[model samples]
Target: MNVLIITAHPEADSFNSYLAAKAARVFEKQGSVVNSVNLYSENFEPVEGKIFYPDRQDSVRFDALREQRHHWEKKILPDDVSRHIQLLINSDLLLLHFPFWWFGMPAILKGWMDRVFVYGGIYDSRQRHENGVMKGKRALLSVTAGAPENACGYNGRHGDMRLMLWSPIHALHYIGYSMLEPYLIHGVRGGLDGIAKKEQQKLLDEKVEDFENRLTNIHEWPIIPFNREDDFNEDKTLKPEAPEYSPFVRHDPDGWKKS
Candidate 1:
């Protein structure tokens, strides 16, 4: 199996980076071909601009989608973008590692998605969701958060993690990846703050074990809930009768029925 690990932590010794390296080793031990992309080390350019697209269809007006498509069709995509795409194309499983910054991914990682997942090449109007080019590939998010586990839970101090991650999760699903249940290591900052240092270390160790287990048994991991093509109507709204895949689509206070 081919596994691509993309890490977006700025600090080399950060918990997320440690976990990413650990994941690589675990996957390698399982006899999988592991390839890692450290965004910080790469000094990846996160912004999409005209400078990256010299050969544009319309030089005056820069439409990112059109330019991306044009460059892809002309086989002149930026070297970095093209290389990232090639890695995704060749991987069976994609592991995304990053600390949850402001309840979302780091700018560099977000930029990776923006540039690497080309608008017309990997996905188009017709080639999204179930028909996405990456449909058969699997993606797993290994996230680190400063908040305590309870704080990120439903009705906890922090908002529900599921809801916070919905956009990115849906984006991954939209791009055709079968997403595995995210691996979350909570209370990360607590460790650094000297809050229950011994206990936090134990928890981190346990999380590492869990991550190793997940990697060793990657094929058996359950996919996260995502609305399928058939679940939506022609207008792209949920069918009134279809099961609600997420809380976002629900209207009633009772919310989504477990499917």
Candidate 2:
């Protein structure tokens, strides 16, 4: 299998970076072909701009979707975006490694999504959701958090971790990835200042071992039960009989039956 790991972390020594490297090694050991894209190291431009298009479809107003489609049809998409898109197209499994910042992904990672998941080329109005171009591919997220794991639980001050992940998870689903259960490593505080060095090392080792196990058994990973094509009605609302996949979509567990 072809595995692509995209890492978004500013510091090379950051925990997120370490997880990306470790995951690549694990995948390779399993006889999977691995390709890693380090956003920071590659100096990838996360922001979308008119400068990327030499021939503008709309010179005055910068419509991202319209331009994305236009450029793709014209075969004038930016070199970087085209290259990244090709990588995504070829990969069977995609691993996203990043730090959870302010309850979401870092800016660069968000930027990568904005620019790389291009419209027209990757998906169109009728080609998204369950029918997305990359429908058969799978994706997994590896996120590092500074807070303790309990803090992200249902009653924790940080709110439910699944709720925090809804947006990105849904976006990946829309783009046709079988979103795998995310791998999270919490309590990744900057350094071992407050705790003893030995304890810190022990904690790090435990997390690394967990990651190794997950990578070794990636094919057995459960994909998130996202809504499917049949789940929606003609108006785009949930079908009356469709099962609920997320709290964000079906506020009440039994709400789908009432639709």
Candidate 2: tens digits of C-alpha lDDT, residues 141-237: 9998888889998779998776797777778878888899998888887556645657666887898998899789877988888777788888878
What C-alpha lDDT, on a 0 to 100 scale, does residue 3 get in candidate 1? 94
- Candidate 1: C-alpha lDDT: 0.87
The alpha-carbon lDDT assigned to residue 114 of candidate 2 equals 92
| Residue-by-residue lDDT tens digits, candidate 1, 97-125 | 99888988888988888898898899999
Error of 1 at 56 (Å): 0.9
Report clashes for each candidate as comma-separated counts.
Answer: 0, 0
Show model 1 residue runs off by greater than 4 Å: 190-195, 251-259
lDDT of 1 at 136: 90
Model 1: ten consecutive residues of lowest lDDT: 250-259
- Note the Cα lDDT for every prediction shown: 0.87, 0.86
